[model samples]
Target: MSHEFTVEAGLVIFSYDGRAQFGWLDLKTGAYHAESDGRCIPDAIGAIEFHSDVTH
Candidate 1:
């Protein structure tokens, strides 16, 4: 499956099959994908979410 968040934070791709995974993140460029660990996302999600001070 996939997920997309429409905001100044750009889009996040949430994917899963038998295990949890993430990808396609722009990160420092201000746009990114859910390709890592993050605070805003669920721990089980195994995805990267943005921080309050997310810099570009």
Candidate 2:
């Protein structure tokens, strides 16, 4: 089984799967980012936020 959802934030759409995977597409640049091993969107969002904060 699989679970998925999509959220639009500004020019980007965040796509998430319940089975620890997700992807995001940037409407403007047509760029995207994807990864696995996330339990949920919030979990992955938190990790991305953390990574972004720490990296920059």
Candidate 3:
């Protein structure tokens, strides 16, 4: 998928109509609908951490 989305002043738009899928709207006057890959790790959790290739 082409995640070629761009934003002016670092702003983004996202929405969900409770239909089926979620999507991202770019600032280029275009709408990009993304699909669920349906592949997820069981028991996934969220956290606040920093990771990098060089430093943490």
Candidate 4:
């Protein structure tokens, strides 16, 4: 599904209800890269760190 979107500065703004989020979209691959709050581990390094943490 495609959402209505726009580009401001360098970020792609998008939403379904007008309350939107900003991110960098790869036009060639349709990948959206956004800032993380450090809670999501999308890489091997992050997965390793999260796996090694005893407090989780």
Candidate 5:
């Protein structure tokens, strides 16, 4: 099973899989950066909630 959720922050969208895997994608440039790749997640990205039906 897999779990995922998305958060919209201004021009970018943050995507996270329930397993310490997350990244932000720039809407304009289409750039993506993962937390494990040395990219910093902004403070604006606060708590995240995974819906009960968020598994596939």
Candidate 6:
């Protein structure tokens, strides 16, 4: 199964191989800011950190 979703600037995708990859998306334009390179948690964590910094 494959799926794609966005949480804030974070983009998460689950591929047919059952691997979850991470990337970034431009919030305003809703375009991809970065392509998924098989990264996972760390990329997501970075997005969360960025969001926290902006919201605080």
Best by lDDT: 5
Q: Candidate 4 regions off by >4 Å?
A: 1-8, 37-56
Better of 1 and 2 by lDDT: 1
| Model 2 misplacement above 4 A | 1-21, 35-56
Write down the TM-score of every candidate: 0.19, 0.23, 0.22, 0.31, 0.26, 0.28
Model 1, which residues run further than 4 Å from truth? Answer: 1-7, 18-52
What C-alpha lDDT values do all the predictions have? 0.40, 0.34, 0.30, 0.34, 0.43, 0.40
Structural RMSD, model 5: 11.8
Give a tens-digit lDDT track for model 5, residues 1-56. Answer: 47555633322324443234345555585455453574654433333333343332
- Report, for all candidates in order, the number of backbone clashes: 2, 0, 0, 0, 0, 0
lDDT for 32 (candidate 3): 41
TM-score of model number 1: 0.19
Off-target runs (Cα >4 Å) in candidate 6 are: 1-8, 24-56
Better of 1 and 3 by lDDT: 1
- Clashing residue pairs in candidate 3, if any? none
Error of 3 at 34 (Å): 0.9
lDDT computed for candidate 5: 0.43
Encode model 6's per-residue lDDT on 25-45: one tens digit a residue.
555844433353532332232
Which residue pairs show collisions in model 4?
A: none
Summarize candidate 4's per-residue lDDT along 1-56 as a digit string, tens digits. Answer: 25643423544344434433434454595554443432221221111011111221
lDDT of 5 at 27: 50
Error of 1 at 17 (Å): 1.4
Q: How many backbone clashes does candidate 1 have?
A: 2
Worst 10 residues of 3 by lDDT: 41-50
Model 2 lDDT per residue over 1-56, tens place: 16543433322224445332344544485444453431223423311221121211
The order by descending TM-score is 4, 6, 5, 2, 3, 1
lDDT of 3 by residue, 1-56 (tens): 45543432221223333233333333384434342443322222221222223311
